[model samples]
Target: MKISAAARFRRALLIGAAALASLAPLAPAQADGLPDPGFQIVQGQTALLVTDPQNDFLSPNGVAWGVVGKNVEANGTIGHIDQLFAAAKSSGMPVFISPHYYYPTDHGWRFEGALEALMHHIGMFDRKGQLTTEGFEGSGADWLAQYKHYINDGQTVVTSPHKVFGPETNDLVLQLRKRGISKVIIAGMSANLCTEAHMRELLEQGFEVMVVSDATAAAQLPGMDGYAAALANFRMIANHVADTGTVVGAIRANHHK
Candidate 1:
């Protein structure tokens, strides 16, 4: 009953698509005062925040696997994001994957005691330029490959942000601002932590934020409640809370306007 990596990815994507379809009907065909991509002078003004969809968070064998609970992994949400990517491509909106990249000697390794000990044991953070020893090209690299096909489509623009905190990337903020992006659609791993951080920061920076409920995950620990709780918390701060389909529908409707 073991699932292969490819199979897991496929399953997650399918689940996400199904979720998106269900929400399509609920979204309005048009909403007044909302920024519509169709009339917007700039193309790719809308940015899709694909946060930390890494193998370590998505793969069962990753270091934080059981600690954050099984739901934090990407296996369940990859497919949903794929559907969003399709919508973004059709709308000419820009997709950004905020990957968590760390060097062997990076200071990020010293944050959490457990993670540091594990990295030391695995020699991933060694000063001698040793790579991760957990196999399959490690989490970050593996996630990049898993989504390589999407990138090849030339619709999504990926960025590697090297910050321990989700909202700490100045480069990302600057890029979005430079592009005149006033709103952002977010989806990614560890909903309560990284996802929340990003949403808060984006809102604080004066960008309207939409959080895709089913497209994000949270720590798998008890009382986490996975997507449900994450969605509720996001609803409080974000401009809108919707599933992948609803967001895609909004984007499409706006694009066609």
Candidate 2:
């Protein structure tokens, strides 16, 4: 039987489509949509997100210490975040670190909001410009030493720096989407600010979020308890809120499938 040229073209198209479909699930969660609006985070479809694990937020000698030292110590945030990373690795889950940094140019803005102005004055999370690595080695912008193994390891991904409090200010959503992550297990510093902002924005973007409560801390001032305020919102907005132990157990249970 003689086949028409147009018929041969159609046959080629179908063959190409099937080949593409087979390559879609590169890292699991190959489907674009979430299982449901409310999601149960499993080993394959979710990532562990730790934000602003920078020295400025986690170290006692950091500039922001005067504000967060007590809370950070009391909450044991450093150790908890470390544990979360360890468990995520054990379960073979992808880990994403969202960092915060500002350059010299960031300080020169004429009109700044209260927190922005304050951060500039305090020199918090300050690293040299994108071109220079100065002050980044041991400065407040550096990651906590305890987490070096995890963050520096080739497997973990560090997303583009977030200038403001939310993931919208960075490539976080892009990285997550590309990796087929439909859910996030999140914990990090500054609960009321960065952590909460990430939660709010991720939820709005339709990613199910489970917060590790004790793995995050907030700066407490005389009038406001930052952690306290963030806790209320996390409980109400996040798909789930639990401690490191609980989340680690769940991750382990779901692993190796």
Candidate 3:
């Protein structure tokens, strides 16, 4: 007996639905996981520019210290940063270092109110101790001395951009563009505030951005999960969120080319 026309139509519809269901998983994956952006690798077309990886920002002795201060020093982000610097030097890729330094406050009561005031009130800030016209000096200067091997080895090019924010200072964006750098690898201290701001600006400017997860830190604010939140926001806006290992692999991959 021949099947009825209605039954054949129903069978076709069911098969079509089943096929669609089978493809549903792939649909989201395809939509979400596009091939790594062109800037994923450190070679050929991208530059590895670390933001404010200075003694003050990355070291406990720095004014804007973070929970990762000791960890960053111990885990060799300092050394890894140096290695990246060396790679850039060898490849002639521009390695920009945005160190944080401030001129002496010629005027007294420069920063009287706001968060600085609160930090001071809570003994978080000090004038002669933490705030001074010191750069690559004092105990904070130790890391720079240790990492000087990379500088002396001709493995790194360093530039200090003094601004309230790293990405905004010293025509950094312009310089990067001039060097034909379309992708920026960002890592540094206070991930939630400065790093987050930089990532937003970079994304807005249409440059592919990658935040090295392991190389950044956040303040241990009370009841504030600033670091994790910053990472989440960065992951959403950035071209990719990679750890130091992935970043290293990408850089090495570029070297082979």
Candidate 4:
């Protein structure tokens, strides 16, 4: 069986092309218009991670309402976050909360970022003391009234407060890892800051993160649309981004009540 020189040359070229193709790096998601890399809601392995679900962020009378209220109402963020809480609890999925608090001592810091300075000036999430409930009941640092039931439940894990935007300063990752949570369905207040930061960090920590878009809102300044910014980042960074209804449906479908 003798092969022609031309045929052998063509075969060599094909083999070389295939080898090169195998070595080529795949195009990034954004470069290819971003295909959806979906995530599954496995009951025990996946948990709901909500950040800064507090009075200051969600309540109409709280300190940050001036900047965050409009976006919150428009997105129904408060309600959506509650829905996620309900779904997670009913489905027996773990729920982890990452709250934010600023004590009197935090105000004494030498320097702070723009938002941190503003937060201190405005006294957002200011508690009486770390260990005292004195002025904490109705304060900005307290949990939103409606969410208290879910959050206060003995089963939910509330990690120490994240002083800044992300969970880096908190024990959230430790809590999640201890519970065997490798996939996180994330939601909560001030989307552009805490929510996005959590998504980025958890992804870096080797967890599959899916963001619940409508369940979080952000401060929309005159020139800064934080919610819009957060949405863009969520699409680019998270394994998937979905609405509250869609996420709740997934949770219910995947786990029995």
Candidate 5:
């Protein structure tokens, strides 16, 4: 027996509905064609990429203190980054530290950019040598004591040290890719420099990035407000720009739910 024309149309419509239903769960669909524009902290696929959480940037007694101290204090950057670490730990998200450390030979380079020359001149983030896994103590290259427990050996994934600015100079991208992390939640020093560089590079590499704005600080200059400039760029290009509290809340919800 042959099927009726109306019956064939109904069968085709059912098959089309089933095909769409299968594809629906492949990726999230937003009504307005907007990327999930809300805070999305994917539990295991997203890792926290904190750049240069070191004494030179976060502590009062370090070399960059003169430049970044006031902003650090005003923004409570130290506590905010710590808060992010704590939440990531509780939520079981990978915490990757992309540190900046300069060795003795780095200062010997004859040619340097403005910030590179300035950092060498100021003796910022100067480590004795790169041969040791143990970082220096009470030095510009050291991790703030408050963060040792979290970033210590075997406790966290510390990517290769980046000499100048971004994750491109280090193994950060490699580590993230190896761990299947395609989304990064970033925070840490000099909002316009390293943190901004991380954001730019990660986006170029096709990863979705969210920046914790208040968890990072920047050096204030006579006319240039570094953090403000970074915040603007993050708002324009990042998948999301959120504060510490907002991030922490999302982390909790993602992990617990």
Candidate 6:
């Protein structure tokens, strides 16, 4: 039987695809020799660190909502963070919020990065001024209404806003060190940006950091999946990356024990 050239080409393509598929694992563990140094929540020594839990990153009307809202909803980030807050408060564990804010003076910077420029252009986390709370209520820089109860409680340590992605320029390290917090459970908005940055800096500062996998989300652009990227980094870099339910369970179990 004489086979047609086009039919032969099709057969070759199918064979190539099948060969490629066969080369791939049915279920890759993705942890090729990676070690997960698990974290244990301890009273007084462990704290909850939430980054950028403000309207700009967590609210529907935020400027960056169009880019990040999908992931936020998919991960149930808002409710998860609320749960962490409640757990921390009930457990008598300290809660630290590393907020992100940009005052009017910040806009006059001579140079900025890509996201910085975009954030400035879009007015994300823009506040009236540092000295006054005027027009701050319900603004992008303001805390999400639901989180206000937890954050404004006299106990929660709200650090100065981190202007950039990380806590390098902020007093987060000082606050943590002063409180003798050696372990931190981190969660919050825009997973790849502020949340991940906080994790990295805290780890560098000698804090055993565990990132809440679903309690944080990120912007998903056409070619970029910020959430996926952040997830990969969290698994590879943090002491442990667990889902909200697991983390919440651990917190409750630790406190109840």
Find the candidate with the highest TM-score and give its number: 4
| Worst ten in a row by lDDT for model 4 | 23-32
Which residue runs of candidate 5 sit more than 4 Å off their true CA positions?
1-36, 133-135
Per residue, candidate 3 scores C-alpha lDDT tens digits across 105-214 of: 51234565454454344333122323454433444423356555544454444554434554665566776676777888887655776677777787888788888777
Q: How do these models rank on lDDT, best leading?
A: 4, 6, 5, 2, 1, 3
lDDT of 4 by residue, 127-221 (tens): 87888889888788989999999999899999999998888999999999998999999999789999999999999999999999999999989
In candidate 4, position 137 carries an lDDT of 88
**Candidate 4 displacement at residue 147 in angstroms:** 0.7
RMSD of each: 16.3, 11.0, 8.7, 5.9, 7.7, 10.6
Off by over 4 Å in 6: 1-32
Question: How many clashing residue pairs appear in each of the predictions shown?
Answer: 7, 0, 2, 0, 0, 1
- Model 3, residue 85: what's the lDDT? 61
Off by over 4 Å in 3: 1-38, 42-44, 66-76, 105-143, 151-162
Question: Over all chains combined, what TM-score does candidate 1 have?
Answer: 0.67
Winner on TM-score between 2 and 6 is 6
TM-score for each predicted model, relative to the true structure:
0.67, 0.83, 0.67, 0.88, 0.84, 0.87
Candidate 1 Cα misplacement greater than 4 A, ranges: 1-44, 67-76, 107-140, 144-146, 152-155, 223-229
User: What is residue 108's positional error in candidate 3, in angstroms?
Assistant: 6.6
Cα lDDT computed for each candidate against the true fold: 0.66, 0.86, 0.61, 0.90, 0.87, 0.90
Poorest 10 consecutive residues of model 5 by lDDT?
A: 27-36
* 1-257 per-residue lDDT for model 6 (tens digits): 99999999999999998976665564233456555667888888999999999998889998889999999999899999999999889888899999888899999998999999999999988888989999999999999999999999899999998998999989999999999999999999779999999999889888899999999999999999999999989988998889988988888899998
Model 4: residue 65 alpha-carbon error in angstroms: 0.8
**Native-vs-model 3 lDDT?**
0.61
lDDT of the structure predicted as candidate 4: 0.90
Cα deviation of 157 in candidate 3 (Å)? 5.3
